[model samples]
Target: MIKGIYETHIQVSNLEDAIQFYTQVLGLTIGQLDEARRIAFLYMPGGNKTSMLGLWEQTHDLQTRHFAFHCDKDFILHGATEFLQQNNRHPYNFLNDRSSQPMVFCWMPALAIYFDDPDGNQLEFLALLGGESRADLGVLSYADWLRHTTTA
Candidate 1:
């Protein structure tokens, strides 16, 4: 049985640029590179070899993908937006409301913020919240999630 994701691959327009972005910008460590095949594998920080990301270069008819990275609750709530902004990334929410704020998915009771990679691939930083599930609330700002959880 599958316990968790071990690896995932995405098509990138340029392998080198993608590697640099994931390494220098996102702080992933390079695991291996295949120059002939124009592919690279990267290891997530503190992943301890459990997680890997593959980037394959493809210039024609490329398809983008989405993925989420697990983050600490404090970082997600306090610093994720600012970190993204400082790195010139635009943070968005599931609602696409144009505000750069993390939103809470009441069903999962998880907070998350979304942004796009250079290839327009959607990526998310997410952290689970401690609270009773409130699926009826759908998705809302973190502040609202806090208020409702505390009062209810």
Candidate 2:
């Protein structure tokens, strides 16, 4: 019955910093702001104000959270990675592996690149490459995934 994710809320240290990171780095659009409550809503691509990520101000002991934006195109993932790197953001692979580039989760056959926000929130841009259900294949490096997909 659930069709798609509409929204998610996460706490941030400062709303302004969060806004800068999300808007400038991640390229998400702002929807609404509750300055009194110290909260802001960031709308994702194709959101049209429907899909949102709420950022509530929280300073004390903020634990890093993970969230991903589903990229509609493979180039968007790679382009985002480049854009982030140019902005002094370091993209990470599984296990915080910066040495390796963005990887492919063979389980979903999706390409993913991960990075952190100003408040250390782990964020990702994921692009689904195919509609193959093969979780048993596990995660693969970008090159490996490409080779396997091409061969199979």
Candidate 3:
């Protein structure tokens, strides 16, 4: 049985760029990097969390994927802004500079602002401290799987 998410893997175009982005911009600590520089691991010391990402040279482009982080809205928003300020790069849609109106999922309890890696893989900083009804959603309580659809 699954307990919790352990780590994640993502492919990047350049190893040094990825390392600089994750460590310098995002403030994630570099746990390890292989001798060949094709694989690297990152960690967020504040959250006791760890994730791995890998990149290798290829002739053709690779499929893009996203990574999301859950935290307080203000923390992630500020983090995104700080990242932009330090790296001298704007958000994919300028979320870091907009103080007038939120263009994305800010109104929702789960705040998700997306940016792209050097390879164009979508990445997100998500916040869940705002407003979601985590109250009375029904879920399966049985030990066994639902074998038949019961109308009654």
Candidate 4:
């Protein structure tokens, strides 16, 4: 039986750039690099050396992908946007309202912000929130989520 995701792979235009972005900016640790294969393996922070990500260089007809990183609530709420902006990454919510604010998926009750890598692959920072599922609410700003949580 499957327990959880241990690793995921994505195609990148440049392996070295992708490695730098994931390691220097996102703080992942390099697990291995295969120069002959143009692939690099990286370990997620605090993943207990289990979770991994693979980047494969593809020059022609490259297809981008999306993925999310688990993060702390405090970091997602108070620091994610600023940290991303400081690193020249533009954070946006699911609504695409042109704001760097995190949004809450009422169903999962999780807060998340989206950004793109150099190759236009969507990346997300997500933190699960503590509350009852509100599937009817869909996606909304963190402020709206807070308001509804208090009033309900």
User: Evaluated with lDDT, which candidate comes out highest?
Assistant: 4
Regarding TM-score, does 1 or 2 come out ahead? 1
Model 1 accuracy (lDDT, Cα): 0.92
Per-model TM against the reference: 0.95, 0.88, 0.64, 0.96
Q: Which residue runs does candidate 2 get wrong by more than 4 Å?
A: none
Listing every candidate in turn, what is its Cα RMSD in Å to the true structure after a full C-alpha superposition? Answer: 1.1, 1.9, 10.6, 1.0
Model 2 TM-score, all chains together: 0.88
Query: Which digits, one per residue and each the tens of the lDDT, describe model 3 over residues 57-79?
Result: 33367677877765565665456
Total colliding residue pairs, candidate 2: 0
Q: Compared with the true structure, what per-residue lDDT tens digits does model 2 show for residues 93-141?
A: 8757555377778787788878788788888878888767557778777
| Backbone collisions counted per model | 0, 0, 0, 0
Error of 3 at 118 (Å): 1.7
Candidate 1 lDDT by residue in tens digits, 1-152: 98999999999999999998899888999999999999999999985999999999999999999999989989988998898888888999898889888899999999999998889899999999887899999998989998899999
Which 10-residue span in candidate 2 carries the lowest summed lDDT? 72-81
lDDT of model 2 at position 63:
75
- State how far residue 121 of model 1 sits from its true place (Å): 0.4
Residue 5 local lDDT, model 3? 75
**Could you tell me the C-alpha RMSD of candidate 3 in Å?**
10.6
By descending TM-score, how would the candidates be arranged? 4, 1, 2, 3
